[model samples]
Target chain A: MEQPMTPEASLRLIDEMLQQAKRSFSRMSFYFLLWGALLLVATLTEYAMNRAGLPNGWLGWPILGTLGGIISAVHGSREGRKAGASTFTDRVFMWVWMAFTFTLVIIIISCVQVGQRPGPWVSILTAMPTLISGGILRFRPLILGGVLFWVFGLLALFQWPEHGALLFALALLLGYIVPGFLLKRQEDGLRTA
Target chain B: MAFAPLDPVLHNQLRLAVISLLVAVEEGDFNFLLEKTGATRGNLSVQLTKLKEAGYIAVTKSFKDNYPNTLCRITPQGLSAFEQYVKAIKSYLDK
Candidate 1:
């Protein structure tokens, strides 16, 4: 026969287990870093090509976007399999990004049909997931990243066409790349500590 | 107020620990629960079976990379029971 736990002990155990589960989902910085770098490269390349009066500059978007999608799929599936367990937080986070991706694709296609730039729309779309993710992770930097996206998004919408790509690139740097690195550092610290 | 009785199925230490973990995550495999609880494999297996039999959790057996895998997920009934248990515990503590 096993001993029974008092209410206090049971409460403590519940708290401890919840903490452990939370830690299990900390390895999420990789996606932010990966997508940020890819988008930054594509945006800068498109901007440079547009400046140099080069043809096919817009091709960078499709090429890099496809590559990012492939990498995200492969990496996400592999990590999911390795995790052995999934949490409600994990499912919610995955759906948020998936919805973002689906809507972004539609926005881009619609913009292309109307011969309009997708920069502002992309920026606006990026903010929601980033902010929601920050709230989910309880990380301030990501939340700030989301706010930066909104600011840059509005700027890209209203500013001159020539500056749209620059603003987009800047948003990726601050909104995705910087916070991505911060999240990675935090996860590393937790692992090592 | 009268004291409500604790659910015997959840009053044991190991069983309660297992349920506590399952309640937090969508699903957890045998290894995950074992790692979190630091219990012997046999002991964890026994407790998992008990919980399953009590309708507190659903257990599924599958394979991963050709290795056997056991996954556990808490049922809605289990969640309701857990909520009741917590309320009961709080009532006792209020005394």
Candidate 2:
């Protein structure tokens, strides 16, 4: 025979159950944003690098820039996971597709740049497919970043081709840096509440 | 993995305490479970091994930073078993 459980004990049990549900939902949403944003950035960086003719040697600059974005994403995600709050599945398919798109975009952008074209118009023109696809996917962060890239791309063509690289880097700041901090805050809120 | 219902260990109070704690926490180290359940080391280890061998939980051994770690997570089967135990206990209380 067992004694009756106290009210406090029962309430604690309920609290624990609620916490598990919150964690599961937050985790799934976090992964969707993290992977989706990363895939877009990787594709765009590679395209920009080839358009700028920054590649000097055997390895193309676009390839290096895409690789750099991947490393940044992996490091950022691992830190979040160690915080034991916001880990999620790595979207392998999404990443592979990103790499393939980068390869194709670099080829096209390089062709345009090699033709002695100077301006953001070429970059903006190339961005249409990504912009439409990102918006249709309902991935707000990626769509937002793609739009910023498109704006900077137009700037390069119309206003200053020389400033394109700097403006593009600023766009990355708005995209990953801001959202990553927001996600960290969101996780902390969930844990505390 | 499907765990056999009515396993004798599932009926024991101390073992049930450990399982219930694990079910809620996701994963816990041995000392954490011992602290939570108030079970002695030998008894907790025996019950954990039984649960692991029964495929109702997975025990991962590693070093966190530097110190040793023994992390245990309840399997899907364990969650069902825990839920069943809750239902059974409620029925018994109702009687």
DockQ for the candidates, in order = 0.63, 0.09
Taking the tens digit of each residue's C-alpha lDDT, what string does model 2 give over A1-193? 1234433443345345445434432232343345435534554555567677766322333565466557656765665334332212224324544664566466657766687442244345435544443454444664675577678777765687666655555554554445445556666677667
lDDT of 1 at A106: 98
Error of 1 at A155 (Å): 1.8
DockQ of model 2, rounded to 2 decimals: 0.09
Give a tens-digit lDDT track for model 1, residues A5-47.
7889878877887777766673789989999999898888988
Q: Cα lDDT for residue A113, model 1?
A: 99
Model 1 lDDT tens row, B1-95: 78999999888878888888888889999998988888899999999998999899999999988999999999998999888988888888889
- After superposition, the stretches of candidate 1 with alpha carbons farther than 4 Å from their true spots are A1-4, A190-193, B1-4, B90-95
Q: Over all chains combined, what TM-score does candidate 1 have? A: 0.89
Clashing pairs in 2: A119-A157, A120-A156, A120-A157
